[model samples]
Target: MVTAIVLAAGNSLRMGTQNKLLLPFAGTTVIAAVVEQIVKAGLQELIVVTGNEPDLVHQALIHLPVKLVHNAGYGTGMTGSIQTGIQSAKGNGYMICLGDMVLITAQQYESLNTTFEKAYHRDKTCICLPRFNGVKGNPVIFSSAYKNAILQHDDPEGCKAIIQANNPHIVWVEMDDDAVLRDMDYPEDYAALINL
Candidate 1:
């Protein structure tokens, strides 16, 4: 059982919106659609980390049967949410995803999931990272071996520090899907998705 944590507790500084996660993509809000996609993937149970506007986010996910945890320290940075989610994650690994990732598909998830299974069966550390067109994306899979490494993180610099420190342990999974690289944060992004 892999724990899937949806990090949705960030202010839309660049996008200049009150609730970027709730912004519409196609017909549905990005968070709603992303959560639905993750749910259908059958990776594991879903946990949404909320901050800023908890009430609205909670309402947005009212229909989904997912656990919601508010990060009081979300303003400090994304590290708090990441740490909070990591601490709450069950099973031997976690598929940490960002709520703003609207373009991610079940096929991309299956690719990473397959990588994790292969690495686990061979007794290898499986830090599954999705790479699309040479660019890496989120919903990174961290193996149990890195539990101590991730749980020990404290600098509050997000995953950059951990990924850099453990470059040797990283398991890069090549993905052809461009959606992995698409994250909506601005009106133009929303427009582009609509145009698609």
Candidate 2:
């Protein structure tokens, strides 16, 4: 079983005072859409790490069947929220999802989850990363074998360093769309995706 960890603790400073995750998308908020896809994928468990506007984030996702945890150290960096999620996650594999990447479809999540299970059977330390048109993308999956590595990760910028160090264990899953490459950080990104 793999647990989906949605990282939604960012301050969204790049969006100029707007909580990008709270923005409307596809008849629901951005974070909700992202979580809905994961839920639809039927993963074993789902944990959402909330920060910034915790109450609002909670309100937006309260209707969904997901475990929401607050990251008190979120202002420090993403690693802390990741640690929070990792602490609560109880699955053999953990899928690190970005809450603002609403474009990723349920089918894509299912595909990645399927690939992670198959690859895990072959190698316990297997990591599943999605790529589109040769470019790597978000929502990578790591087996619990790397739980300590991720928990001990000191970088505040995210898990790129860990991913690089374990390059040999990575299983690059080719994706059919660039949705994996698109994450809404700026207003223009939201504008473009919303218009699509």
Best by TM-score: 2
What clash pairs does model 1 have? none
TM-score, prediction 2: 0.98
lDDT of 2 by residue, 1-196 (tens): 9999999999999999889999999999999999999999999799999989999999999989999999998999988998899999999999999999988999999999999999999999999999999999989999999899889989987889988988999999999999999998888999999899
**Model 1, runs deviating above 4 Å:** none
lDDT (Cα atoms) of all candidates against the true structure: 0.80, 0.94
Looking at candidate 1, what is the lDDT of residue 19?
79
In model 2, what is the error at residue 167, expressed in angstroms? 1.3
User: For candidate 1, what is the lDDT?
Assistant: 0.80
Q: In lDDT terms, how accurate is model 2?
A: 0.94
State the weakest 10-residue window (summed lDDT) of model 1: 119-128
Angstrom error of the Cα, residue 68, model 1: value is 0.9
User: Over 4 Å off in model 2, which ranges?
Assistant: none
